[model samples]
Target: MKQVVQNYKSGELAVLDVPVPGCKPGGVLVRTAYSLISTGTELMKVSEAGMSMLGKARSRPDQVAKVMQSVATNGMSATYRKVINQLDSYTPLGYSLCGVVEQVGPGIDDVAVGDLVACAGNEHALHAELNWVPKNLYARVPDGLAPQHAAFGTVGSIALQGVRRGEPQLGEVALVIGLGLIGQLVVQLLVASGARVIGVDPDPARCELAERLGAEACGDPASAAVENSVAEITGGLGVDQVYLAAGGGSNQPVELAARLSRDRGRVVDIGKCRLDLPWNAYYEKELDVRFSRSYGPGRYDPEYELEGRDYPIGYVRWTERRNLACFLDLLARDNVDVEPLVSHVADFGDAVKTYQRLKDGELKAVAVLFRYPEAVEEGEAEAPSVAVPAVRRGTSVPAPARSGRAPVRLAFVGAGNYATSMLLPHLAQRDGVELSTVVTTTALSATNAQRKFGFARATTDLDAVLGDPSVDAVFVVTRHSSHAELTRKALLAGKTVFVEKPLALTEEELAGVLAAVEESGNDRLQVGFNRRFAPLLQEARKQFGARTGPASLRYLVNAGRLQHGSWYLQQSTEGTRFAGEGGHFVDTASWLLDADPTSVYAVATPGNEDLQVVLDYPDGSTATLSYVTSGPSGFPKETLDLVADGRALRLDDFVRASVYGRKRWVSSRLPKARDKGQSAELAAFVKAVRTGGPMPVPLESLVATTAATLAVRTSLVSGAPVTLARGR
Candidate 1:
């Protein structure tokens, strides 16, 4: 399927053929009929993307601050690669659409496979032939409503929510500034509520359209006509409420709003416009300022949007989805007219040209819609495969062993920041290693990886990479929730698998991977536990030597706060912070103790932001791991110590190490850069694949460490030690 995408680095727009997104649980696969374009919001993004690097940085100071923080944390070289990769990739467009449900996923019962629905959300309601919309982001369209008009549901909801914020009373006069797409809708909604309306905008055509749609009067903001209309509507006072629905850098909208609003009247901002209020005017009137967040009450809450969780109607009278449904109802009843707002309708195939025309000012549109190809008849559409295909059962084929001289061909499933910055860089230019293919959900990310790392091919199909017999190893560097399942599939396909930790979020997932190994008779697996392979730590252990008594180890990981909107915080789906990251510390501790843990006990600070986990080995040795997110940013990320037989080994992050034995020894000097042993770990895995030798870490040890990491959650819940089952 083809989707509209734009390259942020070059500002190049294209309709690229990418893989059809799967219909996951809690959502429905929708075949788009029409998709609405936000001339105000999307055009701003397109314009910003076309700017130079410096211009882009100047446009988004918030993003620049994040880049600076990343540089301080990961160093300049790593930050540069991450930033470049993000900027060069293609991002999707469009957030409002009307579509027929092609297939229903699990947990979706409100709408069926043939339902016509209006979808909202930039991530879900994209300008493609198909979309996967979660339950909370889509509402069923009313009977007899055209799909093109239903495409206005999302934007109409924005207008409806803004009007609700103003609390406009019957017979009250309201002023709506900036007669764009949303402003026009707001004008009609206010009039429908029995409130007289005055509209303001510089565009004479838009102002005319607003008046046609029920505004009492309309004119340009610079003209005295707007002020005169507002005063006349409110009997020489001012309008009772003001809705600012404009978008631009100019502060004229807010100033005009303050000038036209009655004393102590409400002011609602419904669009992304400048908010430089005229302080004295607003202060003297004591205007009640309110912001109508995109859609409504549940806009940014992941639980409400992605997890199918709904707020109680009593407490939250109108959520984003409810607003969407209400707007569609109003459209169906002919209370809100959208026909005048339809400025243009372009074919989906010409999406790139359409965007270019809009950006270059060749197209003047208040609202544009992309008409997709006709949908198939009801009951004809079959459910597509899920995002990740299930691991086939009863597989027993073993991969062909490779000669030592043969290059170990690798195909990567995810090209995220960690994979590009730390893993791929180590293997990209290495001899006797082949970067065969890079597969990602987005076509441009795969293409970016191929361009940067010399991959032989790039694609969005996971099956193609897994089915290829030439690929020797598959790197499962995706999100934590997928590691186990992807690893299981690769193992069943008879390919060596290297997955990043934590290996599995639950015991069931861990059992699933082990079951795959048993079914396929293949155990070539390596989890990313690179910290144990650090040269500094190894030297310290060598100097400390074998101990007569059980050793005590302590590992401190300053796992700081995640940035806002990070997927890591999607704990409902991705698992907890500790569940996803604790395996690294557990594996490192187990490696230092030279044994798998027998039991695990854990505790956390209030709210579970920080955790302390204790693991016990069979030989009476114990290791304590401290994972803290509230630590100071400047503090070292990781520090460890091992003590036994009157000897102590200390590691300061990965930069230096020391052993306090009979004859004291320390690492020569601090290294120029920190090496967490990613390169060495990759080398070991490749060598094992090439030579058909045992994995760098034993399968049993890997399983045990994963079990220990998972047990932390159980211990935290049960408030007792969770004993590990031995002899897997």
Candidate 2:
């Protein structure tokens, strides 16, 4: 697909053709029609992060501390590369849009051919020719809503989410502090909700727009008269609530909210600004304080958003999607007009420039959207790889899912981190699974691969093993770019294969390899979405049962490793960390719940605390991916919570898992060592090969897992939520 991406290295936006994303399980492919450009969110990203290397260290001491810790664990070379590499990569932009479904993948239900939908999350809702959205985030547009207008549905929902949190009752007086796009929408929503409202901003034009939206406009919030005006408007009692809409100001909003609020009034904050609040003033008034994180309680949870399972639609009918529907309803009814606020509209090619205008203060607008081409296209390649290193993994066990014995012989191609650190070790101990041959590009890597884990033989030539009549199945574990190539060659030779995360670099590659599998007529191609075998995850899945109703999961991954550095630094190689490591966590939750993910919207807290991605599954379960780094090492890479069956289950890393709740919290620890999943995952792969009844994880599930990772990448580059397919 032709999409616009920003070159993080030079702060330039480039429009290029990219491979069409493979349809993941429970996802729908959408051909994008209109995608909005969120200036506020895109500005800092299109430009440099504004912190020089030294300045970054000075301002982000916490980040520096984390880097130092990484250095301590991974050594200086790894740490230094992590620091320098990301500073030079490119990022994508845009998160909300309207598109038509072209195709739907396995397990998709709600959406079908020719469905007109608005994408809910970022990343997946790119300003591109095409998009792949999960089922949860895919909201069917009413017949009358225009695609262009519905594109603003996400923005309206974002603005409305804050308003929803404000919960302004009838006759309440509300002051919307910011006049930006979201703030503008907030003002209009407050007015429609029966609240007497005042909109604050330095820009006269925005204030004018607010006035048009039925809100009283005010100048500087810090001015004394503004407070008097609010007091007088409210019969000398001050407004009943405050929405900190205005951004960039310091303690003034907090200070002003305290002054403008009536007794026991509420303060709802949704902007990205530091708040220096007056504790005494607010404490004395007993003001109710609330911070609105995107769409409130259901915002970051997977069960509610992706799996088509939602909280009681009665209590929360207008979820972020519902809110989008609501806002679109208003627009469709002509209750509000967003045209006046849209100051600029440009081709997708100009997406970067639009963001530059926002950052440089050249163009002023409440909303600006990028227009992508009508068809999918590819973008420029960054230093095309002379030879993308091969990655692979394999075993002598074949069709274990249908059979109970190992295959004729085993061979492995492409050994990298996953092999060196994970699969190889597990294979060494897997009963009935023999690692007969290993392949790496270099003699040193091959020798190490062979000796470290006791492979029968190792060689630099991948074909040597593939050509061996003794070899039946081959394991591939190289970089993403080489996965399709190596797997295609191996499978073409009728070899059963167990690949790692992200089956291929692009959909085209995946199709080619899948075709190879089909040509080989072998149904034993397995992707290493290892979490399917993590005993703790299995227990969590079993405990959650089927999501007959609402199911929720809380996953906190101290994915402390790979903050930067390594080839993972290159987007073209491993994509982003989300696609590489984070995909495993996402796929695991999806597999357990077996729900189609509908919508994905994630917000990366500026200044990097790893990427905190919240996926919404159709089954009412939320996979809260807390990518936390720093603090300490050996922090049990992951912890999980499945809050269902009238109780919450906890899994501390893979080693320990338990259920809690009973007036006091109870913790359960699985009796296993830290590196526990490896053995089981390898064993399961062997089992799948031997039986072949069903790949432990279906090819559909493997694809979905990788797609989720790519969706996160879409979000990070685009700074928005990505939508996956709906019905599985």
The candidate maximizing TM-score is 1
Off by over 4 Å in 1: 375-728
lDDT of 1 by residue, 451-475 (tens): 9999999999999999999999999
Q: Residue 424 in candidate 1 has what lDDT? A: 97
Error of 2 at 268 (Å): 0.8
Clashes of each: 0, 96
Error of 1 at 359 (Å): 1.5
lDDT of 2 by residue, 507-532 (tens): 45756775665556655678777766
- Residue pairs clashing in model 1 are none
Candidate 2: Cα lDDT at 150:
75
